[model samples]
Target: MEPALRRAYRRESEETRRADLIAATQELVAEGGPEAATVRAIAARAGVTAGLIRHYFHTKDELTRAAYLSLMDGMTAKGSDALEGVGAAPEERLAAFVSASLRPPVLDVGAVVLWAGYMHKVRTDPELKTVHEAAYLAYRDMLQSLIAALPRSASDAQLRAEAIACNGLIDGLWVEGSILSHAFAPGEIVTIGLRSVGAILGVDLIAHSAMLPDPGKILP
Candidate 1:
């Protein structure tokens, strides 16, 4: 069978090509929707033959699924870096997580656009549902672990409740902050988040201000 027209591949490592394809799909979906990331469109945007997509991904749906995961992975990958860089103290790690979530890239409007675009598909598409469910749990579980690790006295049920509360607080603040980035000063989200979640979990987040990844960057 003849292949569709696309630009020739330039020098790129295997990982780079695959990442490029996934990223191309994200850009397309972010600009339009899931329907915009057709194989041909992805190939043309990636500057590679459509066959190359098949080489990396067996089907267009597979490519889309990979792209969906790519977006989800990007959400957490930076969180991992921020946590690791700050050392293992529970308060510091929690502070880092709070600050990172409320900062740029995470707090920007583009992230909200991409997430809302795919959120509808998650309800109807099984593959996307699995990705969404798993990622959501993973994030919540990370919070659960952090909540449990905090140097406070709490039971299993109490800790789980605290984690769930923190998750909701973060999610709500993320959307509201992303959309209204102009309204809140930089770091305001972090301050408000830690304060709110701290009350939810009975932790003194303000005392941990020194542990914040970006301290006092928020202005009045």
Candidate 2:
């Protein structure tokens, strides 16, 4: 075993272990809120000793904060990944992004539960609140970029305003669809989201979305 090879292996192993701990924390938090994700419970869930958590995170709060950020980052990645292979049309790309956000994985029950579980801490803990605000800004920035790409000319202020509005619309629909999923028909939230967002941006997202070779592929 060469020194370089050994170092690479050790780094990979450490990252894998850290990821496992974060996964365990997210699962416990989702299952029983933040209180269930104690360091002991996280270690047990990850099949590691409690002290092992200290090696990766300075404290339980740090670990919980990491899990929350992981959850939020994953959601943003899901939406961004939806843009892959999408055409240059701004409307199509925006529609795909919104649809991806409103559908499964991003709109899953467990994900929402995990987010809600951390709400209290995010509100009171200054560090966690900073993370929450940063995540929100990142998502909103992405929305603003997508909106800026549209055909119609808009000033920075207008783009920012539209992005905020669209973000709120999507967030509301996402929460309702996740918690009261049964209350709405399949694809209802997606349709509403596209229409509402399209109206805000002064484009027909549904019509543009339909232009795709297989609209159902993204919409579903």
Candidate 3:
């Protein structure tokens, strides 16, 4: 696609313009992966020049890193929203976090497409790997906090192991829910994932069953 010149960017705040560029990158990546999200393509989508993108981000890698971070930040923030409710029981909050991971917005197809587009690069790209690791650690820390809030206290080492295992369960179920939505009934993935993770953490998620979702509500 050819780049379109837009004078409107001249009046836009730096932050706004930067966000536009990142959003453009996400759109392209979601539609056709990195090869299609080239600087030129991003510029076209954002209606900005390649030079302007360089001004905000020093290099292509820098911009891509920023975009990838943006993608992850939005996803994890929404995914962790169930933990944000005030005064909810720890068990319920835990269930919310699991449900968030397997529900809409958090389990969106476009977001999953963007994530898959970046997954291969994160392994070999140093900057991207750094971003991915930081996101991963932050999520694990969030899980640790949730686990620590439980009635039954756990040792630090045990909590760490449980966090890792629980995160694995969430991530794996996330893949299935996003790509293979037909395999399980609506909300079933959330139920199964929470049960599996509750087992790994020795936390009775089922006992907190009142907090879990009603299957009929999550229908596609």
Top candidate on lDDT is: 2
- For residue 44, give model 3's deviation from the true position in Å: 0.3
**Best-to-worst ranking by TM-score:** 2, 1, 3
TM-scores for all candidates: the values are 0.89, 0.91, 0.88
Give the per-residue lDDT digits (tens) of candidate 3, residues 27-105. 8888888778788878878888888888898887888888899988787787576566424688877777777777877
- Summarize candidate 1's per-residue lDDT along 15-70 as a digit string, tens digits: 99999898888877887888777888889888988887888889987877778777
Candidate 1 vs candidate 3: the lDDT winner is: 1
lDDT of 1: 0.79
Better of 1 and 2 by lDDT: 2
Best by TM-score: 2
Task: Return the clash pairs for model 1, or none.
Answer: 186-218
lDDT scores in order: 0.79, 0.85, 0.78
> What are the per-model C-alpha RMSD values against the true structure?
3.6, 6.7, 3.1
Residue runs of model 2 more than 4 Å from their true location after superposition: 1-12, 217-220
| Deviation from native of the Cα of residue 41 in model 3, angstroms | 0.6
The CA lDDT at 117 in model 1 is 80
Off by over 4 Å in 3: 1-10, 207-209, 212-220
